[model samples]
Target: MRIRRAGADDAGALALAGAATFLETFAGILHGRDIVEHCRKQHAPQVYADWLDDAGAALWLAETAEGAAPVGYAVIAPPKLPLHDLSEDDLELKRIYLLSRFHGGGVGRELMEQAVAEARVRGARRLLLGVYAGNTRALAFYARNGFEHVGERRFQVGGNTYGDAILALDLRR
Candidate 1:
């Protein structure tokens, strides 16, 4: 697979992937109707377009082969709290999503590895992310990949309460 920086032209595909993966991954963890509703609002093409232009953001797309379309993506940025308490120069993994078909295929790990490398290049000494408590698969993935639980908080999604676990990986190590 090849990884590359995403351009504004990729907004639509990125949004679609985001919504699809969010829905598929959260199926049982969140109410079906709520998941659909949230994805619709949050994954709009314009939102992705704006994200593409944001100076603080960096998005990477994973493609299967030369000239192949993006099948997965990861976004790392300055952080959106209550997931993090950003210190200057720290990097936050805002979101990481892979098409369900790409799960367990090493794409997610590759994306994260790239993110850490980029963060280091940008002079960040740490990386942070938040995983919903119910997403054991993601939590396990983070744990296996060197992140440690740092804290927890409550998150309200579609008016329903859920636990959010804060995880951090010190890149300086």
Candidate 2:
């Protein structure tokens, strides 16, 4: 697969991919209404376009073949809330998703590696991310990829309180 920086022109495809991936990945874990609402809000085309236009952020997409469409993408930016504990300098992995068909096909790993490499290039000493406690598979994936649990925070979704574990991987080490 080939990975490359995504631009504003890719916003629509990115939003579609994000929504599809979220729905596929969180089907049973998140209430259908909640997932739909979250996807609508988080994957809006305008938001994706704005993010892609932002110079402070880095977005990468992985395509399965030469001149093919992207099947997965990752977004990284300086730490933002609801993660108040992380220092301002810490790079946060805001989103990482792959088309369900590409799961376990190494696309996720390559996207993650690209994000980490970008963080290092930007002089970030550590990478931080938050994973819902309910997402055991994702938690395990992060742990296996070198992230360590650093803290926890509570997030309310669909009127239910869920623990979000904070993970950090020190790139300086």
Candidate 3:
């Protein structure tokens, strides 16, 4: 696998990866219509293009070595989590997804490491993210990476609102 910075031209690949991974991850846990609608809006190529145009946002794409097929991606942007203390010094891991087949291969960890490095390079003091409260696997992954649950949030997917755990990793370490 190769992980590299994603440019504006990579929006389509990012959208595909985002939607596929989102579906694979939430198909059974979330309502089908909610998942479909959420992916349609959140994973659109134009949404990614807009993010790519933001100077404060950074994205990375992971692809296969064989045919360069996009398999995973990560995005970090200005903090949007519901934290009262948030400021320009913080960043949020807006998204991170990997094909289930790539789960145990360290690709997710690599993507996380890249996000941390990029956030630090941008002078961010903290990195925050919100994940479904029921996703034990993802929660464990974040814990292993030193992220701590700092808050709670209500995340909307289509017409459903679900509980989420807001996690933060101190970048000063």
Candidate 4:
């Protein structure tokens, strides 16, 4: 697979792959209306385009081959929320999703390596991500990557509220 930093030109692919991977990952937890609405707003091409256009936000896309469709992507940026107790220099891993077919194939490890490297380059003191409390698989993945559950937060998708566990990995020794 080819993994590279995505530019604004990749917005459409990112949006499409993001929606597909999101559905594959979260379909079990969300109701039909909520999932559809959440994906509509959060995975839109325009949203990704905006992120690509932003100087502070970054994304990495993974393709199966040259000029092929994207199978996965990851995003990292400064925190959008002023969550209590996190460092001012904390970086948030807003997303890391791949097609289920690619699981156990090292795609996620590569993505985390790049994302964490970038976060360190940006001088972040820690890396943070909010995962749905129900997603034990994701929690295990993050734990293996040295992230620990630091707290809890509530996330609202459509009319439903879900509990999310905030995980963090300290970048310092």
Pick the lDDT winner: 3
Q: Give the candidates in order of TM-score, highest first.
A: 3, 4, 1, 2
Error of 2 at 119 (Å): 0.3
| Model 1 spans > 4 angstroms off | 83-85
RMSD of 3: 0.6
Residue-wise C-alpha lDDT for candidate 4, range 1-173, written one tens digit per residue? 98899987999999999999888888867887888888899999998998898877889999998668899999998775447877669989999998989889999999999999999999999999998999888899999999987888899886799899988889885
Sliding window of 10 residues with minimal summed lDDT for model 3: 79-88
Q: Is candidate 1 or candidate 3 better by lDDT?
A: 3
lDDT of 2 by residue, 1-173 (tens): 77788987989878887888878888898788888777788888888898888888899877778666768889998776455566756898988988878778788898999999999999888899888877888898898889998888886555466688889989998
The residue-level lDDT of candidate 3 at 52 comes to: 97
From the highest lDDT down, the ranking of the candidates is: 3, 4, 2, 1
In the order shown, the candidates' Cα RMSDs to the true structure are 1.9, 1.9, 0.6, 1.2
lDDT of each: 0.83, 0.83, 0.96, 0.89
Model 4 RMSD to the real structure? 1.2
* Cand. 1 Cα-lDDT: 0.83
User: Which segments of model 3 are wrong by more than 4 Å?
Assistant: none
Worst 10 residues of 1 by lDDT: 79-88
In model 1, pairs of residues that clash are: none
